[model samples]
Target: MPDLPDISNIPYLPSPARDMNWRDLNRFKSSDRGSDFYKTCLDYSQVLWRQRLPARAILCLDRAWGADLTGDEPILESWPLPYQALVYILQNAPTGVFLGNPRIHFQHYADRLGEPRLEQRKWRSWACWALSCKARPDFQSDPDHDVEEPSLEKIAQKLDQYGHIEETKLWKSILQAID
Candidate 1:
């Protein structure tokens, strides 16, 4: 196995997947030269690839979730790690998809998702915690898992409610909802 191509600009995988020892799923490590994940990314990508994709960019084939589960392509910019995991949980992956590891690069999601909103931080917490539970149940025992009380619908409704209230009065309602 001669040297493969570049990093493919694929997103990294967070360490939340069943304590599998988080790997830089996007980067090709020499140690991974014999791994199936590495080979599949290169093999399938080469077939569908057109004239030229950047040396650093490869077409992603591994999805965050299976096709039946993934929703729309995740709007992953600006969000924190837990939120990113939520999107992965909501949306099913295609034949292959790129999942980024937030611990390694927290800012990437925010950068890609775009500038944050004034209330973004408020609602995102509800989502992140719920998502973390679904994706990494290990965190259920963690103190920060604040989603024990509210149902997911209630959280979404709260987020929607925040979208309507004025910023001046928003804190009152948002705080109430979070509490």
Candidate 2:
């Protein structure tokens, strides 16, 4: 695992209300308060990504997405920023930097998370195609999948619908990278 990115420049922490050391973070990992644990990890992951430490960010995302041992309780369903960030990394990051197949990791988490709504499904397929630079598999195909030109406009519109102004700003920043 990589070192935690420097987030001192960031103005705010997301949840749990206090600074937590590794020990404190670990304590909640196994606790029944899974939502708290998940949010902390997800918030930290966003910080890491904003700091341009994607490798470390991925670790935090892994923890956040897997925080709940029992799959029945879905904590992140309402939070789409993390999923968008994951797709950004998947499409942009080099595969060699990570030990195992990043796509497999993504697929596993996506399966666990289950199929998203139509808008998210389009982004997922588009991201997958962007990563491979090849035709998407039939199973992942979408009517909006324009092979010659993939636009983030639709995804941005979807984010707008969610009404998370901060996340919308973050999504715009992420789009800047691709543009």
Best by TM-score: 2
Model 2 root mean square deviation, Cα atoms:
9.5
For residues 54-171, what per-residue lDDT tens digits would candidate 1 score against the true structure? 1112223221111111112232122112223233432332323343332112222212332234244344444444443454333323244232345667656765664333322332
lDDT of 1 at 83: 29
TM-score of each: 0.28, 0.39
- Which stretches in model 1 have alpha-carbon errors above 4 Å? 1-119, 143-148, 164-179
Against the correct fold, how does model 2 do in TM-score?
0.39
Per-residue lDDT of candidate 2, residues 109-154 (tens digit): 3334432243443444333333322211212433342333355565
Q: For model 2, what is the C-alpha lDDT against the true structure?
A: 0.47
Q: Give candidate 1's whole-model lDDT.
A: 0.32
